[model samples]
Target: MAEVTTSPRTWSPAAAPPHAPHSGGPRWRVVVGSYGFRLTLVVLLALAAAVGILTYGNPAAPGSSGFWVIVRSRFASVGTILVVAFCQGVATVVFHTVTNNRILTPSILGFDALYRVIQTALVFLFGAGTLAATDGLGKIALQSLLMVGFASLLYGWLFTGTKANLHLLLLVGVVLGMGFGSLSTFMQRLLTPSEFDILSARLFGNISASDASYLPWGALVCVVVGTVLWRRRHVLDVVALGRETATSLGVRHQREVLLTLVLVAVLISVSTSMVGPMTFFGFVVAMLTYQVVGDSRHTRTLPMVAAVACATLLGAYFVLRHVFYAAGLVSVIIELAGGLVFLVHLLRKGLR
Candidate 1:
């Protein structure tokens, strides 16, 4: 054999090949290493704690009727919280993915404004007492139908071209939303203080205001719509790549976008009908979700988004209800906090 003189192994650190990136690591390990997993754990623990504190204990005897009643009510409130979180979190994430805009949410599509208009019109036409006496299920159904109908019409008409004018659709939505908002304000201004107060209560996203009666229907809608979105999550990832890319990748870009907006409209209808308009709650949760997950894949990000939203709602509800005993202020506090975060994010982006 020819003198197999192995070249002396390089001992210098500079001569050593760089360590391979851990991209080929076990899937589970990669998942564990990601922020999404850790944050999910934290969120779950916080949610459990919140549920425990909110539902456990009773002034009455443990197994007494009063105790069970209290437990039932707390459970209902928790259910509302979870439902709202799901609708807002999922809707916002999907909306942003489809629109390819991080700053915009379904609220910008006029769902919230439409909700306010319906609510205001209800109060304006029929007295608040009549509105209150209206069947909860009926109200949710009507609201959902109206919203879904309007969105379908708007999107159906605008998205009819070979290339959907998403910008035009968005512009039209913005204009419509502004019009609805203006109408609502005008109606609100015309109302008596008492009526305004009632309408105002309905406007804010308050958990306590949520109807237990609406829970079953709302939960059903959420499950169905959420399942649809979850199943199409990968498609959503493609959609997020923008219309041309998604089209190039064999995605029915316009159709998928239309479907997503319709789903978003349904979700918004459920959540808005259930807990009133949470204009910025979805934005806040979606932003925090992206920050925590650090990934664009819907499968990874959506669950974390739901978790964060749940944790936020539960934690806020717990602290306000248990610690501060100001449960009524939960929505106000959330909106205020979310708005502040939005402003800060905008400022940071501006500075950068």
Candidate 2:
């Protein structure tokens, strides 16, 4: 037995064992260790796919000048792929963030329909020959600017009005898409078969159809805009908490939404102008990004989303172009697969 004079030991809070388990133990480790490994793997896969596109299926000797020429030509396509993926991934993810809905994509805004209208109008009013005439940097610039301006005007007006709400904004966008699509259909009906044929090819979201000249401008714009978006990631995370919560948390919800929408317009416009119109491509990439990264944090997801997009598009390009000998069918396959996935997701959760 202990001596009577011995002081009894007390287990105070300060005296608690340091090695005891914690519910929040090393969370950063989980975040960093798991996400870092996955991100690194994805990035490596994307690099491999890009390299395969550059090196595979060349007829010339590996070190020959002719081999480099083929690689350079393929480089143009790969560059286009990067720009498109970067734009779509970033835009769709940001769009999801501001809207507080992962199910929605930027395509709902009638960007594709507007692009089709612009294309159909070119062939309808100016004739098929004018399509070729409009292939310069100027045409692409004008298209992007017009689309951005339209979106800015629409967003600025709707969000500032007394009745401002996402539902009304969405309703207007849907109505506009329908109207534009109708206008395009009516015009397409008037074109001769040959003119329609020429118009048809331009309307599909064909990465190969991108002009090499557009790559630099696209890349420049992507860098500038991407930086701006990245800087706002924290605000976006707040924004994702819904309008009421964001506003309660001192985040100007409407202002942020308007600004985010404008930026998204710039990205979608650039991508649409470059590769015609990609209705479901962004949706697919964004979906894959969410699945692979398994987190909603914008800081982690933004860059990761772009990397995932690059891998997906590059892999599709490599497979179809090399194995199937059907490079032109990339858009078709993506749309089909994306549509099915979209349906399954929609049905599984129903619309939020």
Candidate 3:
């Protein structure tokens, strides 16, 4: 009787197998079934439309050298738009994730205002000629470093304590941003008309103003920081669980928050340096991403946010440039639309 052992159990084809780790399906199919696949597809379609409108019907024959030249020229603007979209999209999403705030963007940390202050100060102190003499890439590097350093120091001081309060941090940031803005305004008022005009161009976020030379550096920073964030997606999920929960789960909550905020600062610096200040674009993109993806996980939401941002930027550029022939107005229109969306969101939600 003791030797009468049970036979090993076997799974039948009709019965589900024992639980095993998911290896994920085919790449294309997985992407197709993703939460924001339709939004991504729409963005791709809009990008194609934008490229077509920009490159088609050149005075040069379709296959001629001149045609290719025109296409290359058009691509510069498109490239800038895409870069700006990626930077803003990823930065804002990560920012909201780390801060656990839906209404706040990386820009709210005062990077944009700092950028404006930098520009205004440059013009006010050294004159427009000196400002114009500064190289584009050099300016980007300097501004990015300044912003990153400021954010690192701020986060280090404010969050690396046992009694850290995010609300206090945000409130302080808002006050600093307002102070910077007021100083910038005061400086601008004292400038000559010519100097103010030049500074004004630099203050407004404009895709056309992006220097092609800065693209390589901007793309490099974005790719490196983005890859780091992707690698830490699981960690981000844990962090989003709130500081106390994350700590109980063995996450270094303060350290992770500091690191995340530093990266956010870097991304915002690159975007602002490349294309000037975009106050509400990131807010709109992140909000739309949350709505479209319906997921809190960074892995699911980040790409969708990027796609929505790209679509918004490219579609707006195409309509403004080709349809209305007001390419210069693209940033203004975006800010206006984003502001309206922000207002609506606030009105609907009523501060939770």
lDDT of 1 at 72: 82
245-349: candidate 3 lDDT, tens digit per residue: 999999998888888888888888988888888889999988887877888988888778888888889988887877788888889999999999989998889
Q: Per-residue lDDT tens digits of candidate 2, residues 177-290?
A: 999999999999999999999999999878766679999999999999999988999999999999889999999989999999999999999999998777777788888888
Q: TM-score for model 3? A: 0.88
User: Which scores higher on TM-score, 1 or 2?
Assistant: 2
Minimal lDDT window, size 10, model 3: 17-26
lDDT of candidate model 3 versus the reference: 0.85
Q: Where is model 3 more than 4 Å wrong at Cα?
A: 1-36
lDDT of each: 0.86, 0.89, 0.85
Best TM-score goes to which candidate?
2
For residues 1-352, could you state the per-residue lDDT of candidate 1 as single tens digits? 7887788675776765565444456666888877757776858766685666556545878778888888887877788998999999999999899888888878888988999899899888887776788847887898889999999999999999776788899999999999999999999888889999988888888897677888888889888998898899999999999878998999998889899999999988888888888888999989988877779998888888888888888888888887788888999999999899889989998999
Which candidate has the top score in lDDT?
A: 2
Off by over 4 Å in 2: 1-33
Candidate 2, which ten residues in sequence have the lowest lDDT sum? 19-28
Estimate the TM-score for candidate 2: 0.90
Colliding residue pairs in candidate 2 = none
